[model samples]
Structure formats: C-alpha cells, structure tokens
Target: MGRAWILCKKMFSLTLVFNALLTIACCVGILAGFYWYYSGWNPFAPYLVNGNLLWFAIAAAAINIFPSALLGRKLHTGRFLFHHYFYGFLVMASAVIYVVLFTSVPLTTIFLVNNTSPEVNVGRFFLLGGLTLLLDDLPDVSKRIESGLNHIKAGANRMRKVIVAAQVVTGAFSLYIFAAVCAAMLTIPEWVTPANLILVFTVLITGVTAFIFVKRKAWNNLIVNGEENSH
Candidate 1:
C-alpha cells in the first residue's frame, strides 16, 4: 500500500507538469496566432481577429501561469497555502467578473455572429483546467492534514493550531468552490447565481481570515511564556 501510494504521488506530479506544459504551449500558440494576424501573413488572420481569439489567449495565459509555476516544484506547506488562497481569489474574482459580463451584455448575439469564436470557450477551458489542477493536488491536501495532526500530537503552539484550522477550512471551501463552478458550467448560460455568489464570498472571507491568522505573530504565543515568539 505504501508503494502504491508513492507511485500514485509520482504519477500525479507528472500529470501536473504535463498540464503545465500544455498551458504554456497554448499561450505560445495564442501569441503566434496574434503575430500572424497582425502581419497579415495567414489567410485566417481576419477570422482570428474577428473571433476575439487574442483576449481568450490572454485570459488563458493569465489563468494558467500560476498553476504552471506551482506544479513545477515539490509542494511546501507555506507555498501550498499561499497558492490555494491566491488561486482561490483569482477563481472567485473571475467568476464574479464573468457573471457581471454575462448578465449585462447580449452574449447570445455575440456567439450567434461568431459561433467559432474562442472567447467564450477559452474561459470555460481555463476554469475546467484550474479545477482539474486543484483536484489533482488532493493528495497534497491529505499530506497537510496529516502534518497538522502530527503537529497537534507534538504539542503545537496556538498559532500552529490556528493555522491548521484555517488550512482545513480554506481547503474545504476551495474544494467546494471547485465543485460549484463545475456544476455551474454544466447549466445553461453558465452565469453565477446568488448561491454561487455566496459561495465565492465565503471563500474570499475564509481566505482573508486565514491570511490574517498567518500574518499575525500574536497567535503563536501560548500562556506559558506570556511573551510572543516567532515560529
């Protein structure tokens, strides 16, 4: 069982790296497409410009770059927590922005005129990719839980306990957001509803709470010394 677990970890890491490469390749392809469009060297230049592929490319690049960077290394506790909170914010913000745009504009008319346009498709693709990446990192989540438990067993400091609690809450909420977004995508119009808005806000609050706890050294002090000590 131990060997199997190790193999699974290895495979998961490889998968993350592979996804990162694919995202980078997509970014490069988008840039190349733009170059061709601007240079008028490609016959599809006009179509590319009309389809708003550039924006899709930019969005794809922006969304995927962090995950790529994150997967490029072995997961560390601090870095992993930071990644989750930061990526959670991005996902939440993007969902909110998308909802606003989707409701305010006549997206149907735009899609009708450019059925093959990459704009809409790209956002969906990126969101799916981000969710997939997060799900793939579940093993790391388990590792974190185990580590936290070990810390408690070792008589962890108050700050450590708080951090662990925050980690669990933040991680669970992040997973919820991932699942919610996936479900939302399957529905018609793919807009964020009030429930979705609530979920995003909750995630934001959880992340901010975790950040505050992480940033403050006051929580690290126990009653033993009556003085704060840096962890």
Candidate 2:
C-alpha cells in the first residue's frame, strides 16, 4: 500500500511537471505567433495562431483540476491543498472573469475587444504556467502549509471539504463553458474552428482519464491498506 501510494505520488508529480512544460510551450507559441503576426517573417505563426494555442494553454491549466484533486486526496497535506484547491480556484475564477467580461459580453458593450487576441489571453496563460511551476518547484512552502494545517483542530477534514467543494464547483463551471462553446459552434459552424474542437476533445479525454485513474486508485488503495489508512 505504501509503495502504491508512492507510485501514485510520482506519477502525479510527473503529470504536474508535464503540464507546466506544456503551459510554457503554449505561452511561448503565443508570443511567437504575435511576433510573427507583427513582423511578418515567421512561417510558424499561422500554424500556432490558427491552432488556438491560447485555448490549449487554458485547457492544460483546466485539466490540472483532476490531478490536483487527486494529489490533495492522496497527500492530505496543506501544501497539496494550497497548490490544488486554492490555486485551482484562482485559475477557474480567472476563466469565469474572462467569460463574463469578455466572451459572453456583447461587442457593442464598453468591454468589447478581441476576445481571441493572444495579447489578451497571454496574461492568464503565464499566470497559470507560473503557478504550476511554483507548485512543482516549491516543496518547502507546500510542506509548511501542510504542517500548519495539521496543527489546527479538524484541519484535515476541513481541508478535505474545501477541496471537494472546489472540485465540484470547478467541474460544473468547466462543463458550462464547454457547453457554451459547443452552442456557439453550432450557431456558427465557422466558430467550430480547429482550436475549439481540439479544446473540447482534449478536455473530454483528460477529464475521463483523470476520473478513471482517481477512481481505480482509490479502490486499489482501499483494498491494499483498508479503509482506515486509505484516506
């Protein structure tokens, strides 16, 4: 059981790191695309920009929802809570803000701008990427948070509740966004651009895989270590 837990931890860590790298790549690609657009020299800009690189970054950040929750459950540590729940909240909150202030708003409104602009989206991309890297690189902070939370009465239970609540809310919001995007695609088939399809399918696959992995691992852990230590 202990070994199994370790294996899960390692896999989770690797996944987080990979996400961080992917986020960085997406950010770089967006920057490059912008440069190419302005300077008109790079051949790759069309591919990167048309690919909806920013959306991919958002999807990458959003996909972390699953692994973050899994790590929170497995570690039951303060660091994981901060990294997964708190930071996760920030990411989703930003998405909500983007939708409300930009995407969902009418172009005639005061807030009107290119919602798809790389300049507009890059900020969130960097924020998400930076946070993921911070989570990966800063173990001491996470451990300290974990220790602090442990010192509080019923901290573990409270933290668990918070994590669960965040996950539920985030999941619902993501679904809502996905549905909205699909509706827009249907309304204007041209909106079903390559990037939109990629984002939808990527999120679908990532969500399903995360669900299966977390459920199977929980079941296996229960069998290996029994209910008492499984938590």
Residue 14, candidate 2: alpha-carbon lDDT: 42
Worst 10 residues of 2 by lDDT: 222-231
| Tens-digit per-residue lDDT, 1-231, candidate 2 | 876776577457546544534443433444455555445543123333333334443443454543443353445323444444455456646654664565443423211232455544544454454455445433334656544533532343445444444434444443444455566677777767654664455444344443443344422222111211112
Q: Which segments of candidate 1 are over 4 A away from where they belong?
A: 36-38, 41-231
lDDT of 1 by residue, 57-81 (tens): 2332233322333332233323434
How good is model 1 by TM-score? 0.24
The candidate that wins on TM-score is: 2
Q: For candidate 1, which ten residues in a row score worst on lDDT?
A: 222-231
Local distance difference test, candidate 1 = 0.39
lDDT of each: 0.39, 0.44
What ranges in model 2 sit over 4 Å off?
1-114, 149-180, 193-202, 217-231
